[model samples]
Target: MVVLTLAFVSTTLDLTLSDHARKERGWALSWSVVRSWRALTAGTPRPRPSAPDLRTFDGLRVFCMMAVILEHVCWLASLSYVADARYSELTRRDYDAMLMTNSTLVVQIFFLMASFLLAHKILQQRRKNLPLMKTFFETILNRIVRISPSNFVVVWFVATWMERLGDGPLWKPLVGGEAAVCRRKWWTHLIYMNNVIYPDDKCLIQTWYLAADMQLYVVALLATLLLRGRRAAVPLLAGLFIFVTGINFTLACLWRLVPTFVLHRPESVLVAYGGEPSFNVLYQSPLGNASASLAGLLLAHLHHALGDAGVRIADHKVFRAVSVLCAPAALGWAALSPRLLGGGVPHPMAAAALAALERPVFVLLVTVALLGAINGVKSWWRTWLSHFGSVAPRLSFGALLLHLSLNKALLATRLQPIQLDRPHVFFQWFGVGVLSYSAAIPLALLVEFPTQRLYKEVTELINKYKQPTQDIKMDT
Candidate 1:
């Protein structure tokens, strides 16, 4: 209620601003629903080298988000009372089930991307001679402002109105159960400690990624500052990656945990596995996942250090061939290795090694692909991604917040058990993807963009006041 009301009032004020006032407050006009909608729907053209846009990631992020929703869709379907009791189990035993089992690792791409963009932005800002401390504080503030409004709206909606929205045999347990958790532990989310503090009972369980990302962001930022312009930076990142990987390996071995989710677990057990000790202690831990963040920071520095020469190397025929083969191979190995390791059988040492290397290998491949994209590698894939670059990136964050809730609502509203099959699951995913992105539009335009604009305006006003003498001198 509060979020919607504020969005409405802000939109009205922005739209009603007179031409003269609008001209004077041009940047502030970003609070306008009209402009925000345009930005959220437009397709941006490819930019020249000088453009600041990371267009490659726009489609990548949006697609990755959609995939996450699909994963949940599959998981939820498996959890629900399906017509065929054996469907979920049979499907998981199939060789192709590796995709679903390993899909969780797709999130590593996001961790890498977030840190990569942050490091890149900080490096660029540093070139303007800004104080490092100011940049650090501003970065933190900006991230909070960008992420919080949509997040708050989501959390608030779940805790308050979600149960009222739908009901069925499964509604209370599926949707209301989560809402109950949200109401009790919403404060953990506000502090970005939900993942660490309450490993098993997260309100929006998918947001464990956000908590891990936030924690890693702070650590990565501090490391960036300490090692800025230092030659030892790469070595330190390498060491961190190894250290994090070792922790994952050690914990997986000690806990006798699988490298990834054991695909062949009973459908009932699989659904409840999220709260299992393995996931809480190791799987979602920032320490276990820090390698991806470090990888991102390393990639950003390497890109900045390499410049155009790196682009030439990426474009080389030999290098391109090797990359083409190597990247997919790495992903394939990460996807299939756990299943090949006896499907979480009593091979603790082997499972431990797989757990340790699975994400790192995937992150390595993603880093290579990102490097290629950043260097403007020509491909049909890159071209398709660029087409949606303008709008999707803006909505990706909102979609992340809203998709899970939306999916649960969709499932809970069903009057009967769904048929569980690949085609049915795919159909459900298509609907969820369309609806999730559609729902995200309002959240982004109303809550996320407006909050960001308001924050920027307030910061600029503060800076203006702080430099009053400079402004007066300029006027003179």
Candidate 2:
């Protein structure tokens, strides 16, 4: 109920702000609604530090995390009909479409922002004399430790439960059927190589994002190593961006010419297409995601070079205002361009144009939002958002692992009917929300927490084992 209400209210406020007549009133009402919503949902603001710096980058991270959570919540609510028959009558395509689009866009924004922040951190660490290769391995290892442990627990639970529920034989082929692929590839998931094989595949739901992120990190790390310091970084990144953009445009053209390239394989198409050419471009394509990471690294380099002065100028009021306005406008363009090109049967030229427009527009919007959020406006609301951003788990990788399993679990148990057919949809959504949250939290605490600890321990032990050999060589 809380998630649905907040989503509805926030969306309503967003719509109202778009209307000139309602602008002023809407702004006021929106804040008021947010205050009430927070009170109802979280119940008592977390004790905060006075004059908290409200780290903008952290705030953006939190936003991404929450956006993903909300996206999952919306998805679960939408799927409530799978478990229970009552929800069948209540399902609405339009509502589901809206939820899916909004969730997808939000997740994209999160990825873009994350890429930028991570790149900046990586560059900074390199400057501090950290071995780039060592840093890269550590980074990937850390991510695995942080994400995989909790995730594995969830997977085990869901898989075991499904077996009990009689969904199918425990070991089926891992890559086909509606839910069959996930069942089969359970081991592939454990190793985190799912993205390499089928980058855009969503059979295991959110797991696709985890695989994509890992692949992009590897690519970005390699590019950074080859490019070296600040001098080579910009051109290398820029060239790579252009190359990826071209590839995407070409793919989009192919998609248009041979609709079969996309339509024939719906699952593969969504996974592979990603508004770009090449199979699995969206999921496994280094261009789309790596560019954002590179952009972020550039920003971080600029910050180090220019110090606060540089950051201040970039975050100047005028620059932020412009970015804020432009970001949404760019996103709006990307979203509506397909329709403007003509919905049903677009001309080849029009389709190509639309496809070409998508990559740049998405990149621009994401870049601007990152800049603005990092150094735009500060207010109580922004502060609150920053808090959530700080506290939300860096467990997206883990969350992705668990999401599909949980969805299947819910489906097998027939729990969705309660939400689907209830007289008050919000109430039903609340119940499912509780169930999902209950399931996720424990897994997070028990499995994820210990796995991260073990990762650290293992790393330390390896370092100790290697140190004595170095000492012996020195004595020699």
Candidate 3:
């Protein structure tokens, strides 16, 4: 009713008021929104952001993005035990082939990429001498706007509409928990607290990431403020990184926690093993994931410092060898991590320490490897990877938001889950990706892209107004 009333009033004022009066009453803001909507939907569309593009970075994003989708597809398929009798067969077939379900590890890459790009951008802004307060809010709020509009629409649908659209042996189980949680605590997600409160009853299941990343972004920006224009920034950042590592070490050692996806196991596990096994404690907290983002930030700082100093790792054979080896080493480490820790309790004390250090270790390996890839290193492997990665950065977020629900919707409509096979899984992944990307294109264009432009224009307007006011005050 409030929304309707606001819509009515805005339309009425637009129809009834003069331009000057509308401007005076701040009705123009509403009309500007109207115009933005029209322009986004019908006008010349804005171009993709043209910041210095690193094919390797974007390309890596594309790879990780697809990996995330594939991971979830495999996961949700495994869960069709809720509907299909052959579920164990399905799981055995996939597990029979060694498909691990702990795909949540891809999120660490995302955290790193997000902070890496953000650090680079904010460093540019600092070079331009952007104000600290404005920079902080603009950085944080821009991220919110980027994710929230589509998130709100999706959450609303999940809560109010998703279950009603389908009914089956599978539909209730697949959608029920998520729908119930969103109905109760969607606001927590809106403000990045989803992981902290009743995390077992997670709404979208995937959104724990957004929450952790948002919390980390706030930390990153505050740290950025401290580092701005400081000669001692690197040392200070290193000190902060050590402090964060210490905190994570303390948490792991205190609880002897293992990192596992909350969803991969039966919901019963969440109840049976409450404290350390609880998703909220080990997997979902900002502290649990802080190393990846901070590592990315540190890498971004190093990249910037190197660029300013005219250093090129690409031409150096030793650096190139290290970069070449880093890729397989990271991949091997991740692939072997499960066996190293073995996905259960009673890990060796060494394994516990490895679990704590694994995150930062993975961060180092990836950042170093990708830095070489993105830095024009002229490697054939990078060239091959970059081909797929170039568009990943833009499309990845949209795909992430769309894929989980798309997977649910697809499964809910299935009369019976198919028996698992390599061929079947491949086809399922390909088809779902096709549909998800198709839906994501318009969502990105109509909703995500335009809101970003409108936001940028608004901030530019604020800066414009502030400059004139500053001039007036100075003259006075």
All-Cα superposition RMSD per candidate: 2.8, 14.0, 5.5
* Residue-wise C-alpha lDDT for candidate 1, range 1-476, written one tens digit per residue: 66566656656766888889876675566567876776667767756775333676888787788778777887777666788877665666565566765777878989998999888877655556667788788778888887877887799889999999878877998899889999999999998999988676768888888889989998888778776666677778888888888887787778766556552255434455555666776567888788899999998877766662344646588656655565566557655776657743547677666767788888887877677767666666666766674666777887788888888888887888889778987899889888888888888887787777778777777777879888889999
Off by over 4 Å in 1: 1-8, 23-31, 42-45, 50-53, 263-271, 308-311, 343-346, 469-476
Best by lDDT: 1
Which one wins by lDDT: 2 or 3?
3
Ten consecutive residues with minimal summed lDDT in candidate 2? Answer: 257-266
TM-score of 1: 0.92
* lDDT comparing candidate 1 with the true structure: 0.76
Ordered from best to worst TM-score, the candidate numbers read 1, 3, 2
Q: What is the lDDT of residue 172 in candidate 3?
A: 77
Write down the lDDT of every candidate, Cα atoms only.
Answer: 0.76, 0.49, 0.68
**Alpha-carbon runs more than 4 Å astray in model 3:** 1-53, 82-102, 261-278, 341-351, 389-392, 460-476
**TM-score for each model:** 0.92, 0.67, 0.81
Model 2 misplaced regions, further than 4 Å: 1-102, 163-179, 196-203, 257-279, 283-288, 308-311, 326-338, 376-381, 394-398, 411-434, 461-476
- Could you tell me which 10 consecutive residues in candidate 1 have the lowest summed lDDT? 263-272
* Candidate 2: tens digits of C-alpha lDDT, residues 59-133: 555455444554454444443333454344334223443333333444455555555556656655565777767
**Candidate 2 total steric clashes:** 15
Between candidates 1 and 3, the one scoring higher on lDDT is: 1
Task: Give the Cα RMSD of candidate 1.
Answer: 2.8
- TM-score of the candidate numbered 2? 0.67
